[model samples]
Target: MSVEVNNETDYEVDLHDVQKLADSITEAMFIHPETEVSIVFIDEDAMSELHVEWMDLEGPTDVMSFPMDELRPGSETAPSESGILGDIVICPTIAEAQAKAGGHAVHDEILLLTTHGMLHLMGFDHEEPEEKAEMFTLQRRLLEGYTGRPAPKETVE
Candidate 1:
């Protein structure tokens, strides 16, 4: 899988570490090796604009996903269909505040947001109670092994 990370903001993010974690998550989720995914980091103004334009929300959000091909996770024996997975837009400023409030490192918060955005790219949503349960469960499971945090809380974008 090709995990492309672009930091468009002024904040100092570990792009290399973010890419590594994104690649690992995509691999663990069984995304096709040929599929391409982009992770973009933006500032509050940009995020606010996108939030209003795309989601019609009022404020800047943590993360937003724009799925290109609607790809799903594949099995070990069968790779997922090859296509552009999607673009995950993250706001570092918002994430930093969320991390501070959640008592976790900002990087871990970004990882959680990234994973959550990826799951959205894979057609996951928390609009309903059941959907929220399933998506959050999977998200926590995916992060716990890496962040050593047993329970990861949910945040909206």
Candidate 2:
């Protein structure tokens, strides 16, 4: 899978690790190897602007997904079509505060959000209770499977 991670923020994150997690998820979910997905790390200001522009919200959210092709999950025999899976934009500043409150590493929280955003890209919604359960259950499963392996570490630049 062509998972491109672009760190536009000053936060010290392991770009490769995030990309690997995304790649693993897409591969496991049967997304085509030619499909393109971008994970972008941005500052709070940029995120907030996007939040307002796209979602018409007030403040910066942890993550936001902008899907392009509306791709759905496919089976092993028939993978999803190759196309732009869209962008998952995350704000590290917001993530850090959430991690502190959740008592987990920032990277782990980011991974959770990444998976959450991925689910959204795959047309999973949580506006309703049933949708919430299904999406969250899958999210938890994906995160659990990924955490079993050693996730990438943050590097100080």
Candidate 3:
């Protein structure tokens, strides 16, 4: 898998750890080894602009995903086809605030957002009750599997 990380914000984040997490997620999801994904960390202002432009939302959000070649998770016996997975844009400023409110480390929240974005890239969504449950459950499982720690509980929106 080709997981590229670009930090365009002034906030300090461990790019290598983000890359590792992305790699781990792709591997666990049985995505093709040649699949490509980009994770970009941007400032709050840029995030807000994207939020309004892409989602029609008002403020900066934790993360947003722009899938290139739509792909889905595959079984180990039949991995997903090689393609461009998507782009994940994260706002560390917003993530830090959410982390403080949730009583978790900022890095952990960032990782959780990364997992959420990755799931979205793989055609997962949380619009309905059942969809939300399934997506959040999978998100928590993936994070716990990668970190070997209990994932923070996600609240219903």
* Clashes (N, CA, C under 3 Å) per candidate: 1, 0, 0
Q: Give the TM-score of candidate 2.
A: 0.93
Ranking of all candidate structures by their lDDT, best first: 3, 1, 2
Candidate 3, residues 19-56: lDDT per residue as tens digits?
A: 99999999999999999999999998999999999999
Candidate ranking under TM-score, highest first, comes to 3, 1, 2
Please give, for residues 77-138, the per-residue lDDT of candidate 2 as tens digits. 99999999999998988888888877778988789889889989999988888988898878
Model 3, which residues run further than 4 Å from truth?
155-157
Better of 1 and 2 by lDDT: 1
The C-alpha local distance difference test score for the whole of candidate 3 amounts to: 0.92
What is the C-alpha local distance difference test score of each model?
Answer: 0.87, 0.86, 0.92
Tens-place lDDT digits, model 1, residues 30-140: 888889999999999999999999989999999999999999988898878999999999999999999888887888888889889989998999999999989888888
Kindly give the stretch of ten consecutive residues in candidate 3 with the minimal lDDT sum.
148-157
